[model samples]
Target: MIWQIELIILVLVVLFGFGALATKDLLSAAILFGAYSFLLCLLWAIMGAVDVAFTEASVGAGVSTVLIVSAVLRTTRRTDH
Candidate 1:
């Protein structure tokens, strides 16, 4: 495993984490979270933890993203005064 690649992925994870927290839109935040999960999966794969990577890819990035996006789409976005 290359340290440079690991460093890059780690940086991206941090950026995505911050982005998800800072985004105002729920959908965008969900997408960022998915990307974050995917990067973590990649890191795990590179580190030789294929099983954990697969689990994260499937459950974290895949199912969770779909569920969050669908939930966001079905809800009404309203600012009540």
Candidate 2:
């Protein structure tokens, strides 16, 4: 069912968000954030917003993830007190 698919996507997004927050590695966190965005795109598509889903998949998951990963790569991966 559509609702079931939406629920699954929502769960995946939540899990990815938690993973991003809990991850120690910046690159891994960025990847998790990208996964979250991808799940959001799926949710949008299931809701019948194809245009919005396309934009979210491309911009949110693809471009934003690349930018975040590049930024992470430019900085130190570890934090110091």
Candidate 3:
């Protein structure tokens, strides 16, 4: 595994994590979380953990993301002053 690629992925994961936490919008946060999960899947693949990578891609990035987005979409976004 190339350290350079891994390092780049790591940086992206951190950025996505912070983005998810910092975003005020629920949909944006969910999307960022999905991206973070995808990045983790890539890292796992690079580390030779194919099974883990597949699970992360399918469950973490795929199903989880969809569920989050759906839930976000169904919720009201109004804020009380």
Candidate 4:
């Protein structure tokens, strides 16, 4: 049962990662990346690493995602290259 839960989280993380990479919109990609981080943090928590999970949840899901989205909003979505 525990392994199954881990597998599900792993699959969700992979899907979110792919979605982030495939998305054309910077904001959408940032949101997907945040989702990926949330899933990873959940997996870590389930695996008994509470401190690491807390850090990942706070920094990755909360701070990093918000910062990335804010940066995207401040800049152009299109790349010159």
Q: Please report the candidate that would top TM-score against the real structure.
A: 3
What does candidate 4's lDDT look like per residue over 6-81, in tens digits? 8889999999999998888888899999999999999889888999999999999999999999899899885444
Worst 10 residues of 1 by lDDT: 72-81
Candidate 1 per-residue lDDT over residues 33-81, each given as its tens digit: 9999999999999989999999999999999999989988887532233
Ranking by TM-score: 3, 1, 4, 2
Looking at candidate 3, what is the lDDT of residue 12? 99
Expressed as tens digits, the lDDT of each residue in 1-81 for candidate 2 is 467777878888899999998888888899999999998898888878999999999999999999998899899885545
lDDT of each: 0.91, 0.89, 0.91, 0.91
In the predicted model 2, the residue pairs found to clash are none
Residues 9-61, candidate 3, lDDT per residue (tens digit)?
99999999999988878888999999999999999999899999999999999
Error of 3 at 14 (Å): 0.8
Candidate 3's TM-score reads 0.91
Judged by lDDT against the true structure, how good is candidate 1?
0.91
Every model: Cα RMSD to truth:
2.2, 1.5, 1.9, 1.8
